[model samples]
Target: MLSDFLALFFPRFCAACEGALAKGEKVICLQCDYKMAKAGGLTDNNNFVAKKFFGRVHLQYAWAYYLFNKRGRIQRLVHRMKYDQMPEIGEFVGHKLGAALLRQGLQHEFDVVIPIPLHKSKLKKRGYNQSEYFGSGISKALEVPLDAGAVVRTVNTASQTKKSRLARWKNVDSIFDVKDMAHVRDKHILLVDDVITTGSTIEACALSLQHAGAASVSVAAMAAAK
Candidate 1:
């Protein structure tokens, strides 16, 4: 077939492992997908992601799709998604996670999905928000509205990659503002993000939503640093 012929000449590679993708595979190959370090027990209230914000922000639920390891396959995939113009990877992962959540009967828990917004300057440079795409996928799967405009990032803070926990909190503290509180008011918000490092950014965003009168806030991320 022409499709087969094209694949023979120009094979598609897996985003995580860079291995040739077999038929029926998209983005990540099955082997790499199976090998991914899943963050299980998502339905539990005391899961790892929830514990990260125990004393900081109140969360109705918190879950991450994977446990991030330095230089691991997930790191490679995330790097490509954020810096290599591969935003589809985020959506792909989000869709898979969303589907799994749906299977667990969690679809009705959240009223809306809101991705953490990027500052306007960074959004202009990236041409897209990876977290938004992730939220879009979840929104589609959960049959909920995806509201990227409900909140905005006021400060373009320095990277938290090298900062300590307290420093990270300070950097992102009070940096988020609710744009139209009406949209989030009385709604159970599912806050989506690409990664949860020190949990500072998410905490700040959740606080902003809570202050804006959001009925409840939950957190979901593609991965969390181990």
Candidate 2:
């Protein structure tokens, strides 16, 4: 009752819409959730995301939960997770992603889930890795272990948002390094991130995992920018 009383004045807002959240609404409002979740996404094995890496890296499967549009619900949700100190948004996204795969009977296709790591400095500043929370939710719901150290971000690159497609590739090309080869080798790995834009970061990580003898690497994220 005390929490409810406090909520009366300090009302919670939806992470995606910034509208007042009703009772029982956790991160996003119901309307916004439905809008974002209705997207076709990368349900099929051959998808937009998978095509992005056709010549760059070999991916067994690649899919995202939603499309990332500027100023859209997905953008807002990702912004909140990355900048507004609302990391739980990642977990919510992961739950949805896992449920989607489960519905398609693709949840058990991977042996382990690993989030794209952040550099130590950035992680210290952010207090968490947004992708890690997403991975946590997927692992819990999919009954797969989340290996946080499967790959490490060795170089702290600048933001890829303003860079050109080629520039983005150059920025993140060699940023990831495989930290634990034992966990990656002979395993079907799911490499996750918060968003997929130019696909450079994901490609780089997939290549690193493949080079490390991972049987196959699958890509997953909350949103994929068309």
Highest-scoring model, lDDT: 1
RMSD of each: 3.7, 3.5
CA lDDT scores, all candidates in order: 0.89, 0.83
Predicted candidate 2, C-alpha RMSD: 3.5
Clashes per prediction?
A: 0, 0
Q: How many steric overlaps does candidate 1 have? A: 0
- What global local distance difference test value does model 2 have? 0.83
Which parts of model 2 have CA positions greater than 4 angstroms off? 1-11, 37-39, 159-171
Q: Tell me the TM-score of each prediction against the true structure.
A: 0.92, 0.89
- lDDT per residue, candidate 2, 77-168, as tens digits? 88888997777778877987887778778767889999999999999999999999888878877888999987899888756677787877
